[model samples]
Target: MVKKKFRYDVGILFISAVVLFVTGLGISQGTPQKKNPPFEIDRFIPVETCADCHSEIYEQWENSMHSLSHTDPIYNRVAKFLRQGLIDNDEIEEAESCVKCHTPVGFVSGFPTRLSDDLTKTPEIATRGIQCDYCHSATSVTKMYNNGLVLKPGHGEDDPGIKRGPRDDAQPDFHDAQYSKLHTESGICGTCHNVKHVVFGTDLETTYTEWENSPYNSPDPEKRVTCQGCHMYQRPGIPATGSTERPKNPGAATDYSDERPHIYTHYFVGANVAVPAMFGDEEKSNMARERLKNAATIDVDIDPADKKQIHVTVSNTGAGHSIPTGLGNLRQVWVEIIARDRGGKTTYEKGVLDAGSELPEDAWMFRTVLGDGKGNPVINIAKAREVLSDTRIKAGEQMRQTFDMGFVPRKGTTITARLLYRGAPQKLLKQIPGEPIEPQPVVEMAKAVRTF
Candidate 1:
């Protein structure tokens, strides 16, 4: 009996040692150490306070998706749907997971599972969504992927260690500014952008990983581009704080200095026109449309041997990550092809929107499909247990689709190919009944024409 017990004890010690070694290795390689802690409400200064000096930047942020993430009616409705339909049905953990990124302030304040139907009832800071303080106050990230940010709240303007930003030379009179290299890297953005299922442990969003694996993340400076480079266009401007006429680089004594060309604007533009349009911000909606137009390019080719055979090529040229990067399960991107004769009669059409705003059965969609444990399609990401398939176009990559034109008229025909993007799938929108679902507009990313 004593000998058997000693052997068992030895086996337990070996298993413990292996676990310790693996854990230490994970820490060395920057795996997430722990979950995010509760936010300190008092440490959060209102965005209006920062706007006192950074009016221009504040305006830009006010028009961004980050600003409207929480207050958007569609997002609120979805949260409610998840809560009432799923969380109330015993899937409480998954519902809480979404709040970590969507409403980090609320999630950290110990209200992760609750989302009020009335916007006024929601916490003020939570309504701010991905606000400035929640990002600037981050001391470090526990990992590069997933929501593993470690925040160290700053106690208002008088606090010694205020906010950390990219500029090392910035010296604002109102608050302390320290240089943070992490802010300049893509990993910081990855802290919140990359999301994994809280219950199933499946990756739901892999925007950062897609960028990391692409040539855009190359070590060559000329070939490399950070998330901020494209999203935040740079221009010669005064400091975000202080007077508009103030110098771009203000000295310790003076409020302004000579102009510098490296001031990165805070537009934070992405392919999100629907939310801005819903919020009644035409300028931001237009900006989003323009950004989408510049994100990709399309090429069309016809086979010489078989005039009926056509090849359409779509390339994700401008974006550093995949063309339809974040929330792939919800976002929809596809190619719309139409061929017409000289009389303007339609010869062939694919990806046409039906009367109900639904894509045709033959539409080639670039998205990720999720499935439940039973292998059935799952609309709510919280219930997803497996990634059935992902057919998105990667950064600096091209995808070609071959289509049979069938019998074409003897006269020359014009074929038009357009890359289209939608913020959310129509099926998902239909799930939220009785909210007067507005028709989500589809933005054209790129277009090409070919005559045969």
Candidate 2:
């Protein structure tokens, strides 16, 4: 009887151990697994796949900076310059930062330092720049800055790929769609728009931060405006593949049940006209020019005390961020004042580009100056360690410049002031290979003429 009892006790103990082991295994399977550094891009779908349904959006994106981020000749030149510098200094890790945003698919796929200037030689998805699948597959954002995003890879071509968008009730036959509030907010934009120096941790680009602190980010819905609201203008039309006049919906179902007020157009317009012009996208280039023209206002005020003294006020009237926000070190924005006598003879001129497309030494530029560790001005963005000074006009802010007409002007002297913007400094462009030394387009953001 004692032997029988011992066997029964052992059997019960074995059963308990088996149950505990199964429960632990279940818990482990239920827990989320962490993805390590250098994400996989095997699941990324090319932009062409999205074009099958989102034809209009794909066309608009084809001309956008997002598409040219990796393929832009000027950007490629700069990236190559920076990468060679890093390689010379034996900083391979530092070099990877450039491709992290520009060619994200390549960076995350473990070839961060292999960005080729030739787009044809680059990986298919990398050449696509920021494609649709990579964005829609983002499961979460780790932070509001510095490209801190978490993407989930799809298993197969037929898989919906965890599509996340702004709409909740979207039912599509081709893919799974779910609502993601983050998609509608500026935080998602902040992921790639904000940049930090890989070596010094200096805040390189703060376009997102500037908007976050501006009046455009107000809590009041009536007064608030998002980055998408301006860049992606909304109009009544179809959002997906169908007749251009079809109802706004995700799919092409005959039973048109849902209709939205407006479908956001994906022009992604900004101040960068150089790249689009280089790519022969005249419409996008014109749109960029118009956007710049509407971004600021110029006002000329004569000093009450001294008639010879004139104050030119430039205000950031339209942009939600600073006038020359991102890459301010490279971007050039300034007020060009041309005062002339009745005879049309140039009297006093500032901010005039010389024959080499270079601004005069005395030009008052609205941009940020960065300094290296040795306190010397650095044109290479990767070498900048700190901001020396920032003179760009913030959103809803105005900057005034006083000009002393050294000599008394004629009674009817006409003063014409134009707020000019350029994508790159002439000096920088000259250093880039294959780029013509011709004058970069000087977009006139605002202009004012007054007779004093």
Candidate 3:
């Protein structure tokens, strides 16, 4: 495509400019000045510009997870880590794939694909992340996943082109607007939410696929629940889905808009509390915690007749996909079970951390694990020989496990199942460059108590 070709030069020129700046040619006062990034630094249309007219939606999304997609510290460290220990051409391409979805603007501009580029020096628009213009300017989805949304972005503010949305009746004064049927469809969200490896051709993340096979995905037009239906419309206390009553959210979308009976909210909140907390966005972080708590349900039971075993059942009641939905390689979800006798003596325990804060061998991990050809665990998608295991509970599925006790349950024996989640595993976090992250917050999603 002509557009793809145009984007290629931007990275080269940007890199060259950085070289010039480092050598003092592009320096201004104390800061380095951008000497013309391709497509202008405003090709994506600055977030503040969109905020001028759509203040309320802008405010809602300003601190949302989507806004932090590119700037996320963990994402940056992990993505940048791919730049190291690569010799093959195919491996290099695999490393470059992260940008396609995380920074659509930079991906489109063909800059920052190298993975080694200093992101802080990139144009402001590229770092603004998955902002409004990139999503609104989408013209079509060329593929089912992996940043396949074909965009027809306007040439900056002067030629702000047609912006697409769910409403067919919208009439905006500032720019050309059109009702895009694709905007309402789950396929649009699938375009980026699903990730497939470039070389291995394996699906690393199947959030969209998981929903497609679930009961929530109905064929009937009136009954179909989309990614937007739950995620966009969710609030702090309310669950994303799986509840009997989902009250409509009603408000004016913008400052100049009239009140509507139902408007899809823009929090774009997910089950990720770590990123928001790291950025000091306490409000969003707490909302994530609430979302996680409401995402699943847990039940504990003892065999009345046998008295030698206990069962813990966890249901993926709320989510349309897997519970720990995104990037199973990074996310950790496990069940910690504790049992005690009459005098409060710890009779049985599992899911405790060892010296390095790593989960012990007996930890009941509920997530996917990648394996190399020779049966070694690997996190890099490019190096993955195959998926060895996936223990995460799928949508509408119940995962039941029975724990065996050496002795019969006493009359005062108490057992508890605490389902917990964390941002990443200790092994993966240790590989991150710079200061090591210790004592990551562990959130308890579901809890239960039983006595015999």
The numbered model that scores best in TM-score is 3
Of the candidates numbered 2 and 3, which has the greater TM-score value?
3
- For candidate 1, which ten residues in a row score worst on lDDT? 238-247
User: What tens digits encode model 1's per-residue C-alpha lDDT throughout 5-124?
Assistant: 356446644743554465334331221223555655666788887777666677778858888877777787776776665643224555544556777766666554344424466678
- Give each model's whole-structure lDDT: 0.71, 0.71, 0.75
Q: After superposition, how far is residue 329 of candidate 1 from its true place, in Å?
A: 1.5
TM-score of 3: 0.88
In candidate 3, which residue pairs get closer than 3 Å at backbone N, Cα or C atoms, i.e. clash?
A: 411-452
What is the Cα-based TM-score of model 2?
A: 0.84
- Candidate 2, which ten residues in sequence have the lowest lDDT sum? 237-246
Q: Per-prediction RMSD in angstroms?
A: 9.0, 12.9, 9.0
- In angstroms, the error of model 2 at 317 is 0.7
lDDT, residue 357, candidate 2:
82
lDDT of 3 by residue, 1-452 (tens): 43653464365347434543543332222111233223444566889999998887887787787888889887888777755787865556667667667776876776665456666666778787788998898877655656667777887888898899888788888888999977887778886887766555456787887887788777665777888888777766665666434568888767878888777777888777778778778878887787788778888898777778788899988788897877887688888888899899888888866678788877878888877668887888766656788888898888998888767967898998899988877887787779876656789998999987
TM-score-superior candidate, 1 or 3: 3
